[model samples]
Target: MVSKHVKRNYRIVRYVLYKETLLNTREHVWSFLGAFCGIGLLATCQGVWQDERLTVLLIGSFGASSVLVFGAIQSPYAQPRNLIGGHVLSAVIGVACQQLLGADTWYAAAFAVALAIIGMQYSKTVHPPGGATALIAVIGGPQIVAMGWWYVLMPVLVGALVLLVVALVFNNLTADRAYPTSGRFTRIIRRRQQGGRGE
Candidate 1:
């Protein structure tokens, strides 16, 4: 049996913590707007950089991935290194999986996405689009498989590099944000704790 006082206290606490603690700084505002601009750039590029070799939809989705990269929305999954390497690694892995398992249908696709997800988590570069990038390798069929590991070097790696360059420019132009915010700090701390004993 819950008392009215208890319920009221809960409500007041929630309001104070969740609602009253909101912050809306200028940096936050610019990061939000800058992400939209990055989205637009990627969308426009889809029309320009596309080839009919693959379907129209996949090309366009590169644009969406661009948003994830440049958005600077403070997601672990969207940082530049993750944005690039996660997808490239997953794409390469997916293609290899397709070849090994034979890309006939559901199982291979499932394997691709699951492996990609797990791989990203392990690597700590869990970009959301990496799942799609891996699936793209499977569904893209012979053309992708034919790239012979170079597929990642092309659209996956190259595309992410371009997106990162763009993100660097746009995300910095506003003067309120920066990225790759020192995963190295953790590394340094760990090394210090290990006391120079690593082989």
Candidate 2:
């Protein structure tokens, strides 16, 4: 006759342990390498352009992007559509908010992030870093604000593409890891394989 409280405590402990499961050494190494290469490329670009008086290719949001694409590749938010679509949508919304309401107003910043989230949700691209991209557009210093719409094309869109390219390469390097856990890309890949087999 076990006590009910003891049984409940045991269940809770089991659940906690399950949730805290750790990845193997290989996963960690791959994640590290992927993130290092992804950001390293952007950083290199930034270094090369630092003295050019032009907008650099790096942004803070891409760091968060790396966490998802490299460390949590299986996350829906980390998939190709979310990674690219989310950042691009958020950048557009953020820039619009800044231009229409002016970054000086407090509500403008809030609106930028809020609307960006809505946009991502409706578009089915809910990458978390997108929120940061929106906020950066609002609160960013003169250099960012001055870039105006160009900001989206350079650091936001271009930077995301760079990271995406890296994720595509590194995430698929090993047999265990595959990018875009599921999506149109996966479907296309399956179709191609089926076609090859039939041929």
After best superposition, candidate 1 residue 159: deviation in angstroms? 2.1
Candidate 2 residue-wise lDDT at 151? 82
- TM-score, model 2 to reference: 0.86
| Model 1 regions lying over 4 Å from their true place | 4-29, 50-73, 140-151, 183-199
Estimate, for each residue in 22-99, the C-alpha lDDT of model 1 and write its tens digit.
776875556556566555554556567667432122333465676665554466776777887788878887888788
> Candidate 1 — which pairs collide?
none
Instruction: Score every model by TM-score.
Output: 0.66, 0.86
Cα displacement (angstroms), candidate 1, residue 3, comes to 3.3
Can you tell me which runs of candidate 2 are displaced by over 4 Å? 1-3, 51-55, 183-199
lDDT of 2 by residue, 80-153 (tens): 89999999999999999999999899998999999999999999999999999999998988888988898889
Task: Give the top-scoring candidate (TM-score).
Answer: 2
State the local distance difference test value for candidate 2. Answer: 0.90
> Cα lDDT of all candidates, in order?
0.68, 0.90
Clashes of each: 0, 0
